[model samples]
Target: MELDRHGLLSLYKTMTTIRHFEERGIPETGQRGMSASVHSSAGQEAVPTGMCANLSDDDYIGSTHRGHGHCIAKGVDPKLMMAELFGRATGPNKGKGGSMHISDMSKGMLGTNGVVGASIPLAVGAALTAKVKKNGKVAVAFFGDGASSQGVLHESMNLASIWKLPVIFLCENNGYAMSTPSEYGVSTTHVSDRAQGYDMPGINVDGMDVFAVYDASAQAVARARAGEGPTLIEAQTYRYYGHTVFDNPLTYRSQEEEDHWRARDPLKQFRDVVIPQGDITAEELDRLDAEAEALMEEAVKFADESPLPAPVELYDDVYVDYPVDMMKRGVNMSV
Candidate 1:
């Protein structure tokens, strides 16, 4: 489906933001060795940007370790995320949680999980809450191919289908599970094929193409909202980095394989294919790229300037030694 000018630009900007956020730790930011927490979503920007576009602030999303892109797409402030990675008190979780645990309940971002397939059950729980409350809200689990192997994900899918919960199991099959490629681990040819085991619809989309992902996710979201239970979407995308910042991808995958995926970069695809087809011009798109860079630079600066959490506030979000003392900490506590 074709998108309007505003929609196209909005998707572009979101993808650009994710790309930059992930790239900040690369040589482009001149701090390649500075942070180990940053997980590169370098090429997988379209999945979250497109899928989250179909969700509202009330609609929840549970993410994974490589979740900066997901949080940014869901309306969390990039500056705060950067600060969290920098271990600053101004972070979403007061810098304590950092990259793996960025949670902003006000924005309906349940939390970014470090554990594989953990988001599935968490999002299912949120959907159950929504169903019980009759809130008419949907919950989404943005997981990966690696997490697809986890038993909890299968259990969550079965439970959601049995109860007709309003949840979408959005999987980002980014070709590899860390250094181990997906082909060696996953039994099914496509992750979505397992959706049938739970008696729900399964869709496989070109995760590299933003518009395709957007359209597919929109339909699945509409189905969930209409009380049609859940749908599993396996977005076939690729990540242009190792499992984490410390990983060297060249050790496992060949440079040619990496080069092949990099050539079909989502941002490049949007700029080249969508821009000429949509109302916006290449110049306008470039302008947006420059703007995104400026915003990320500001975000980095904000993160760097943020203060570190104090030792005294260690129990800020935890069960404290005393209730009255915790009360003294106030209701608007950090995190």
Candidate 2:
């Protein structure tokens, strides 16, 4: 799939935005003394950027814990996401759903799941809705290699295949599922190889290369939109940080391994490919990098200035019609 200049630039912009958001937001969590678990997707920007590039605001996407990239790529506002992480009332979930659960229904981003492989069934259900309505929309399920082993994934795939649901089963195989390496957990050499059992096309691509991921996802998305059932895509990628913010990756993986993946960073790889073609310049990329940094700075400011959710409204979203007076009375009730 050949992308025009505008498409190429957009891809670069989205990837940079995700990278900057993760880089800036993770530290802010620590500074705020937030106990919420944040799984950084710094090294896996290309996977979401490429996949979501093929989707529209109406297309649905179910995300995993390491889903900041997925949210940004799917067009969720970074400032609102930052506010959510900061536990502000202005957040998409009104400060209730933190890092792992951040969701924006307006952008068609189904909530990011904290459970392994949980997003798979959600995406399948969305696809079934699209198929029933004949809405011409597709859904995507983003999961990690660790979640690939979950029974829900296999069950979703089988049902999607039989029902011909318009969904893409995307696996961001970041070498490790938490601390356990893919080789130790997955029986197959590539996770995509498992697609055979479900009678779907399995594709494995270079997750670090945005172009490769974009091309593969373009085909898979097209297939789904054409009512050809689901496609399984395994992106061979790596994560720079640990499973969560507090975990240290060095304990399980070597510094050399981390350095190897960092060298092939998605942003750098995009530059290496585009600059040589003479259509896009290094200065242009640098400008985009600067803009992304500035954007994140503004997002941080927005989050910092935002107010926390009021204590009395705790049950507002939880109950459809809970009485306000009951909330006030409950607030004063002794335990």
Candidate 3:
């Protein structure tokens, strides 16, 4: 877990990229402009960026609704992701699956789910595939504190443990599950504590620190590849915005609480900890910031200029095959 200068620089740049992308995209959700619902991963950038830093393109990751960071960290092109959000034909799913369901199989992103706790089972399935194939790849499922209560999560955990599937259950404990806090919904003291029931190693981490997440994930990934069972990691973080872009968190939580987390802003902490210590210079960090902002600006322009799905192509990507006559009707029936 010894850090190199290059590794620290990549972490800093990736976290900044995720934060900037979410900031630009999620703000368009007020009904005045954007096409789809946006769930911001503003404050929680460190978790995915750090975890995914240890992943390869062949390693699978299942993500939550607020998964722009996960996608970016998993080596997906943000331009394509932004295009998907804009609902353009050039998008990842050609505008069919928007913010909630964006995916890139080539990069091993299973897909971001709109249904809470849904990705856990999917990640287990992906890990099962890897295990059966004997591929040296591990699957990671990124869920929130709310998903910790779902039956599917436990079932997935149990199955993975019994089969010794190469999977990692990562819970981003951001305090609240929508308007309701984790204290209100979850009976467990911490989400990682539930891992004991499934006989897996449970770890609690500071999601605000990228290095911590990377180190823990590296160990879990090594264990899985070595034919060991799954591990559950609960990252203690906070969401800077409301649950969704439309909801105002002020009604449920105090500004003081929000301000407290803001003071520990992951991006700022990275700079403060690394720059003065000489791991990275301010000039290099600024260059990365400029590059990220410029990249996002280009993604917006590319999305704006891209075309929408054509009428005759409605059946495209819908199914493997269908009756010629049924498809010729230019209608969508198979939901």
The per-candidate count of clashes, in order, stands at 0, 0, 0
Error of 1 at 199 (Å): 0.4
> Which residues of candidate 1, in runs, are more than 4 Å off?
25-35, 320-335
**Each prediction's whole-model lDDT (CA):** 0.88, 0.94, 0.89
Candidate 1 residue-wise lDDT, 1-335, digit = tens = 66677888899999998888878734433362335655788899999999988888999999998898899899999888888877789988997787888889988998998888888899999999999999999999999999999999999999999999999999999999887788898999999999989999999999999988999999999999999999999999998988877788899989999889989999899988865665788888898899889988998888778787887677566763666465656667554
lDDT score for candidate 3 against the true structure: 0.89
RMSD from true fold, candidate 2:
1.7
RMSD for all candidates, in order, please: 4.0, 1.7, 2.2
Which runs in model 3 stand beyond 4 Å of their true positions?
Answer: 29-32, 327-335
lDDT of 2 by residue, 228-259 (tens): 99999999999999988888999999999999
Error of 2 at 125 (Å): 0.7
User: Residue 64 error for model 1, in Å?
Assistant: 0.3
lDDT of 2: 0.94
Q: How accurate is candidate 1 locally (lDDT)?
A: 0.88
Candidate 3 residues 1-335, lDDT tens each?
A: 77698888889889988988988866642332654468999999999988998899999999999889999999888998888887779988888888899899999999999999999999999999998999888999999999999999999999999999999999999999998899888898899999999999999999998878888899988888998989999999999998877788999999999999999999888888888897579999999999999988898888878887776566675678866567555664553
